[model samples]
Target chain A: MAENPMEQFEVFKIGPSLLLNGTNVSLTNSSLFMIISVFLIILFFALGTRKLNIIPGKIQVLNELVFDFISKMINDTAGLDAKPYFSFILTLFLFILSLNMVGLFPYSFTVTSQIIVTFALATIIFIGVTIVGFIKNGVGFLKIFVPSGIPVFLLPLIIVIEIISYLSRPISLSVRLFANMLAGHTMLKVFGGFVVALGIYVGWLPLSFSIALIALEILVAFLQAYVFAVLSCIYLNDALHMHH
Target chain B: MKKILVVALFLLSISQGTYAKEGMPQLNPEFWIAQIFWLIITFFLLFFLIQKFFTPKILFTIEQRKNLISNLIKDSEDYKNKISVLENEYNQIITQAKKQAIDESLLLKVELNKRINEKKKKLADQLNIETEKVEKEIDDFKKKTLDNLPEIAGNFSTEIIEKIIGAKPNASNLKAIISEITDQEKKSRYV
Candidate 1:
């Protein structure tokens, strides 16, 4: 009745394929959307800063609201030490949120649904956080793997588990975002197909359901972005403060 | 915008079959390199722009607002303290004025009482002198009137005797006789 729903996930080059050391570095739909998200962020902040109001205009208020939210989140989760990295976390959040929102447009590519993109972002954060830990605590950062109150026999087991979980951070972070975006968009595509298959008279049912799913997907987009940033803050807290 | 959307859809339709033959296009490793490449580029770009351009001004504005609020609170507290001090000074002045007024009124009352008493004593003395003069005058009037009464009676009796006898009687002898008779009457009636 409608085109294959999976066809929407297809990635294709938009321009001439550029071989960078025999690697396909050509721009794709995913890249185009990514660039769009970046420009949108630039445009939004540009508008926010243009007026420079004491009593903020709507855009500036929105800018401040986002800043204050992430600021408070970092402050609450990681304490004062996390304050310095507020802009980085804020940037990460806005980037993901922009990508998510842009993807919701019809016939638009969702960059976040790609596992490699999410994984790459998560890997950068994981590597950065690890380096920070080493910088702050030196060899003592290794103690993050060992349980303090465990018996001697359980130490080895606990250390292995901790190391595994520690290594899994990037995977988990990446998968969480990638999976949520993939599932939501996939469901939307499927329901959109269902509306087409059901004909004009019976199509209203699936159409309404797709509308509802769209609302939920929007919520998920915001939520996943929040989670990604907050988790990063927590990881930083562990690295910087190391309460236990 | 719609043109862009239509173009994008047309592109997707034309290019779909190449990747659509697979199980999952996301799992295909062919396109991962481009996606990750752009992700890194765009992510860092956004991060750089927001950090460089917007944050400092916003933070400065927020900090200034905080300082203004705290200063306003401090000023109000200072004003409250000043008002209390002024109120205390005003209360002290009012109490002092009230005490002075009460003291002045008491002094005025005492002075008025003294003046009234002096006037009362002077008026009583004046009334006593006037009363004494009036008593003396009354005494003189009574003496003069009583003395004249005997002579008047002697003359009246001589006239009575001359009329009865058709001739004048001896005036000196009659006066002496009348005097003796009046004297006896005075002793019996006036004394």
Candidate 2:
């Protein structure tokens, strides 16, 4: 029988444990997958952009498409002030997307399946966006919770809800990605286990379902990354404009 | 062989230890530090690579292509303007040349007519002057010839008479007769 479906999420130390400042900063399976994603992203971008041309090939087209997609997304969502953060957003999108894809392969570990990784990213964006908001608007940044045209009687209630939503940004962002990756990968493992246990006669059934799930998972992966990046752009837009 | 067996047993126990954990290993606080730490490192590494290298080249290429297109369009527009200006100048030159040619032709016709009329008048005047001189000379020659004709005729008549009769007739009588005959000839012939 195949190992437990949950075993896929285990983080095993791949090398000698190292303690940095009394904390265990040892390299593990999760770290290995993260590094692999980084390498893959570098390889993809490097390979596609190596030869610049007026007319592009297949890979170059894909490279430009991704860049333009995020570029236009930022411009549409966050306007031109978001132009400066194009690199950060592009990196974030590529990193998440590549990590998601790399995890789809057999025997590969999904980095985004871990809550800590996604939460870390989301917290960083959330914190950075808040700082930017405060910097751009000063004390007026708090006015985002106080919407216009509301009756003074409802202002207090509206502000509470708005504040709650604003505070939940990082949690929702992190959980959305982490849950989706974890659930999809777990489901795939569970079904894969079913296929093996059922053997040749009925194996094809679960096997086909898993295959279909993979296709859906791939779409989910790309979508989650897009959602992640777009939401960040929206947050940035709010900070810079303080209105939308 | 004993060492290898012990190592395998140790590895199995370690793997078993993780599987024994409750709920999600993701919720486990133990691995959170390493995962977050590595994620930051790799995320920044990816960010550094892309920001430092990729986007600039792609942006430059795209911007260059856009500039090339816009420049070509601008150049074409400039050339189009130049073409229209040249066409206008050519048309103006043609019209100007045509106007000049018409003016010169009209002027030439006027000058030629003036010269012809002048030549006609000069010829008529010269002809009138020649005719008047010729008529005056004829009148003078007629008067002189008439004046000389009577004397020569009287002398010739006397010589003839002297030869016929052996002497001239009476002189005063001949004078009277010749004078009377000359007067009569002048009146008859001149009148």
Q: Highest DockQ among the candidates is held by which one?
A: 1
Question: Alpha carbon lDDT of residue B7, candidate 1?
Answer: 34
Each model's Cα RMSD: 8.7, 14.0
Kindly list the per-residue Cα lDDT of model 2 for residues A1-244, writing each as its tens digit: 4767778888889899988899998999989989998998888888888898878777788889988899999999999998999999999999999989999999999989887899899999999999999999999999999999999999999999999999999988887888788888888999999999999999999999999999999999999999999999999999999772
lDDT of 2 by residue, B76-108 (tens): 999999999999999999999999999999999
C-alpha lDDT of residue A150 in model 1: 86
- TM for every model, in the order presented, reads 0.75, 0.69
Q: What TM-score does each prediction get for chain A alone?
A: 0.97, 0.94
Poorest stretch of ten by lDDT in candidate 1 chain A: A1-10
TM-score, chain B, predicted structure 1? 0.51
Cα lDDT, model 2, residue A54:
71
Q: Which stretches of candidate 2 lie over 4 Å from their true place?
A: A150-156, B1-20, B79-191
Candidate 2: residue B82 Cα off by (Å): 5.5
Name the regions of candidate 1 deviating beyond 4 angstroms: B1-20, B105-191
The local distance difference test score of each candidate is 0.86, 0.87
Candidate 1 local Cα displacement, residue A113, angstroms? 1.2
**Global fold similarity of model 2 (TM-score):** 0.69
Best by lDDT: 2
